[model samples]
Target: MAEKAKVYFTDFRCPSWRENLPQKLARLMMTAGFGDIEMEGKYVAVKMHFGEPGNLAFLRHNWARVVVDLVKSQGGKPFLTDCNTLYVGGRKNALDHIESAYLNGFNPYATGCHILIGDGLKGTDEVEVPVEGGEYVTAAKIGRAIMDADVFVSLTHFKGHEQAGMGGCLKNIGMGCGSRAGKMEMHSAGKPYVKEKKCVGCHACAKICAHGAPVIENGKCAIDQNKCVGCGRCLGVCPKDAIEAANDEAPDILNKKIAEYTKAVVAGRPCFHVSLVQDISPNCDCHGENDAPIAPDIGMFASFDPVALDQACADAVAAQKPLPGSVLFDKDSGCDCGRDDLLYANHPDTDWKVCVEHGEKIGIGTRQYELVKI
Candidate 1:
């Protein structure tokens, strides 16, 4: 069998044809062997990060519009989706999540689609998918709307991530699709504790804690270790910086869990992936604001294999030279001789290979791919 090839089209030399984006993407899909009716009449869930309110650099609605139109032209009914956040601010509830999506220019007529919060109200509506992976033990929780979709497409804004090395297709689907409690499970392997110095007895944590494990004792709210289940609910709501996750130096474990969660989200679905290498923020778009991009707008990639798509996207981005006046303006950090320009320039400590390798090991997709340019 031939190796799967990832389709690539750069942001360069594509400005004049901006209005033809829908037809362009449709033609690309045709070349990839997808018919218009294949997407037509299907519940095409276009999974994407609408981005936090304060974050400026995110996937544009024009791109999503192109995708929605293509799905429609092919007879697919498309709807934009993202799960409720684990954080305490905006998008924690369905109403606020919808409002955030609207504020981000994803209104019904704008993107030629409707927006739905993947996990229902309060971030609790989810179905647990059973997987026999040794590390995952019981199962992983995924958003029901995503689970029920006839077809799925993860359109990710690829960028640097502090914890996962990079946020590509796998991170976009795994961590992106997880409900709040599911996210709690992924991050809960380590226990959370209260820092006495930062604990101001604000009682926010106490209010959100379901078990009442945190009680005001001696003028300070304290977490009863015995009663605490490490659910992480209190940690997210804690106004004071008292509650924090324990040291988790095991990145490999975290990567594996992310992969398993991604599996749960896309299990048995005809899924596709697209990663845009523009405005590559250092932290996730979950943050309120995005720092300058480390590189110029690179390109867009598409593939049937999420893992290979991500790996290919990373390789393409890492081959580019860093743009001056961006986050990685300095060139002499530590390039001994011939190093990967993008990786070495943007972040010297991170290794993106881990995400692709782990993803491949779990049968997410093969790293081998051909670069078919559109």
Candidate 2:
């Protein structure tokens, strides 16, 4: 049997004389062996989500300052990063993405580090990395900037996810690091298509595609499926936001792909992970608006093994009772309020275990863990 990975945990309790939560988080990270990494003069990519415009559940910049300060203390050059979103939102492109991040209070002044959108201006700048033991994706399209970093660190906000059951470390790293095309590949088996009503025949997509996928006719645009390569460049340049990817991939396969993409990211790097199990929202922070939290704040977690960290977090969430007014407790008369698996009870169709199981199968990390309290 594989040895259990050590996961460090610290609750959000502080007296007037005690250290603050951020300082305690820094201590938790050090206890998890974050200080052991050789970080002198290396570029460290701190991967995290800059919440959507109106989402209040996302991690505050104060939490990121802890990681940034620690990295700087070790002489590591750190920068915050997250790839552009596949969906049409505040974070689809670099400029708008930065604006949204700033709008959500993740500016350099707040986080004590610069923000780099992993993909370039249009979400097309990517590096095709070969997934060593991948079953679904052979070559995962990761963001160029994220892959360029010498060290990777994930700062995740552990929460309930509608599609993947829970958005933990793996979700934050795998789905977060993938380029637009990578996201499309994981979410859909089919290529992108142009919506006729939204298409203005701007010919921007036609000009950008080397394959001549976008064809203009009758002052409207249509994508030729045979010629399209699914690079996802058209989605960024569409003035009318007409081009859209097909979300046809099954939930299980999507979870597997997320695991595969995560393998492509942290396979050969010095990686560390930290998760704050607070504001356990029902949906992703990608939503423009955030609903009430499903559970009360549990605490913070840190680990060298992301898989173990995620497993520990899932376990912690499972131990909590549902918040009365949240969706988990009010899902109708058939709601399983007493269910031990809160994540599954919240989203019955999604199984969060699939991602971790696939992650372990792909040789990233094991799900078994020993929680060490600080």
Candidate 3:
């Protein structure tokens, strides 16, 4: 058996006289050995999600400010970053992505760090990273800017997810850091398809596709799977949202792929992870709107082992009863089965355990942890 990883935790409560949430968060991070990283003069990428426009559940700029300050204190150059979305959204391009971050109060003045859209303007900038011992992904297409960083830090918002069961440290660093093509590879089995009703045959997808997979027939476009390398460029260029990536991968595979991508990012780099289990929303922040939290705010967790940190958080959330008016509470209240499995209860189609298990299997970290409360 392996030794347990140490996961440091703290509740949201702060005494009126002492430190505020941000200051307390700083203390929590320091206590968890964040300052031990040799960040002197290194380029540290602070990967995080700048929530989709209209989704108010994303982490506040204040949280990022604390992290930026910490990095600066350690003489590291830090930047806030996330890759362009594969789907049509405010953050599909670099210009729009920066604007979305700025609009969401993540401006340089607010977070004390410049924002860099991980993938380039059109979501094509990428670096192929070979995943060591990867089962699902041989190589991961990561954003070039993220791969260029000397050190990596994941500032994650822990919450329930519609697909991966739970969006925690691994999801934030893995799925969030992938380039558009990389995202498509993880979510789909093969290629994308055109929604006939939504296709206008404008040739937008074909114009951007280097593979020429989008062929026009009868004034509508259909992707030629044989010609397609699953680059996912067509999905972004389609104005009508007609081209959709295949969502055929089973939940377990999706989770494993996420773990593999995570390995690609952190494999030869110094990394630290921090997850604030607040805004316990029922879906990923990628959604245009966020649902109410299924549970009350838990706390902040920090660790060098992302798998252990995530497992600790999942355990914490599982122990609590769902909030009175939350969607999970409503559903569980009407059922005879227990609601202890709050994450699965929130999204039945996904098994959050698969991600952590695979993450441990790949030598990222251990799920067995000693939760040290502060």
lDDT of each: 0.75, 0.91, 0.91
Candidate 3: tens digits of C-alpha lDDT, residues 1-374: 99999999999998686789999999999999999999999999999999999999999999999999999999999999999987778898899899998889999999998988888887789999999999989999999999999999999999999999999999998999999899999998989989899999999998988888889998999999899999888877788889888888899999999999999999988999999999999899999999889889989999999999999999887666788788977775422235457787788778899999999999999999999899
Q: Across residues 1-374, which tens digit of lDDT does each residue of candidate 1 receive?
A: 64675665544344675546555665565565555236656899899999889998888787898778778878898899998776555677788888987898889889998987887776666888875452552688778888778998888999877777778888889888877667766655655677888788888888888887898877677778788876566755666557765645455666677888887777686887777888887678888889888766776777788888887878876776666666666554432425754654455565667767776777777888888887
> If both were scored by lDDT, which would come out higher, candidate 1 or candidate 2?
2
Per-model TM-score on C-alpha atoms? 0.85, 0.98, 0.96
State each model's C-alpha RMSD to the native: 3.3, 1.3, 1.5
Which of the two, 1 or 3, has more TM-score? 3
Using lDDT as the yardstick, the better of models 1 and 3 is 3
Q: Which is the leading candidate under TM-score?
A: 2
- Ten residues in sequence with the least summed lDDT for candidate 3: 331-340
TM-score of 3: 0.96
Clashes of each: 6, 0, 0
